[model samples]
Target: MRLVIARCSVDYAGRLTAHLPSAPRLILIKADGSVSIHADDRAYKPLNWMSPPCTLKEGDGDVWTVVNKAGEKLIITMEEVLHDSSHELGVDPGLIKDGVEAHLQELLADRIETLGDGWTLIRREYPTAIGPVDILCRDADGGTVAVELKRRGEIDGVEQLTRYLELLNRDPHLAPVKGIFAAQEIKPQARVLATDRGIGCVVLDYDALRGIEDDKLRLF
Candidate 1:
């Protein structure tokens, strides 16, 4: 990874035109041939970025231009470079999620019939263009079901499940897929949203799901 700190201005020319005036900023040229300009805000989101499958061209002086196959251009003009350095960070091992959500998904998949009588799992992490649905299943009548599992349910979680439904319902084999929002605790607003969208909401008992039959699950 190459990191450059510079006093630079940036311009983006493509679907829309954007510009960032001269200021002290960090420019990142990653090993994947992606380039991004960052300000000291927004946590991890870069102020501007050109993703991979793009080309970076450094011209004479301090100007750099990046272009993509779609003909989009990200132009970085540096008046002065404060620091320039590169580092070789080896391949990452990927994220190892701790035992909550992952564990819940596994538990639910193993005991799929807990959802309802005759309910069966089709796939966990069912693939789609937008992203994977946490659980793909079949209901009592063999209708397709897509479940989005979360540690805590919120309106955002409902919205995520809604997207998966839209994509899954497009496939002929899964055209009539319905969604279930499963979480430990679902917010009232999220429950309402899921209801409004005709999506089922299931409040899971973590302990019971871990195989203790002391408390029961609720479906709304």
Candidate 2:
């Protein structure tokens, strides 16, 4: 059977362009408005995201079952389905989430310096008693900014950032610092808490961060 695949360039917020294919199976977007569809059962065949190819089949429940080259099975929900299929095989979702979060942190560190003439990213792996904060930045105004990011969870991580804030608040050396929590989703409770505390937050959906669907991830 011959599949007619057409490529369309999708410009994502001017940051990236992905080539997407017309077919539903193994659709990947390229920057040149080109799309490629994989004709095989390998989920990541087009992107070559995984070696040995991963297979997707229906599982016991509605969730999809993913089997790697080693015959390891992973059940994934619709939300994580794409990440599971595209990334390294046989890896847990949490681990993948962590990696994504880390990558975001690094990107933020690189871009924060260009947020304006004065704003600058201070450092990564900012140490604290609980654990090392992801990114600590100094804004153009000289106020310290504390940022924490998570891949899977909602703003529940705000609770954890609250601790970092307390520590920084106690230490006068940290400057007039502000807190920012970055995540894929922000829960209502966590949002309220952050608002009440006058903290800033940014939320991005998975697709938006990936710049796949027009950078539609709204962050506030």
Q: For candidate 2, lDDT tens digit of each residue in 4-110? A: 23222211111223333333333433321223345457444343221123565655544444454445443323322232122322322222235677777666676
Question: For model 1, what is the error of residue 216's alpha carbon versus the real structure, in angstroms, after optimal superposition?
Answer: 21
> What are the root-mean-square deviations of the candidates from the true structure over C-alphas?
8.2, 18.1
| True-structure lDDT of candidate 2 | 0.55
Name the lDDT value of residue 107 in candidate 1.
Answer: 92
Residue pairs with clashing backbones, model 2? 7-35, 8-33, 9-33, 17-31, 18-29, 18-30, 19-29, 19-30, 20-29, 20-35
| Candidate 1 residue lDDT tens string, 7-92 | 99999998899999999999999876678899998777678887655899999987899997679999999899999999998775
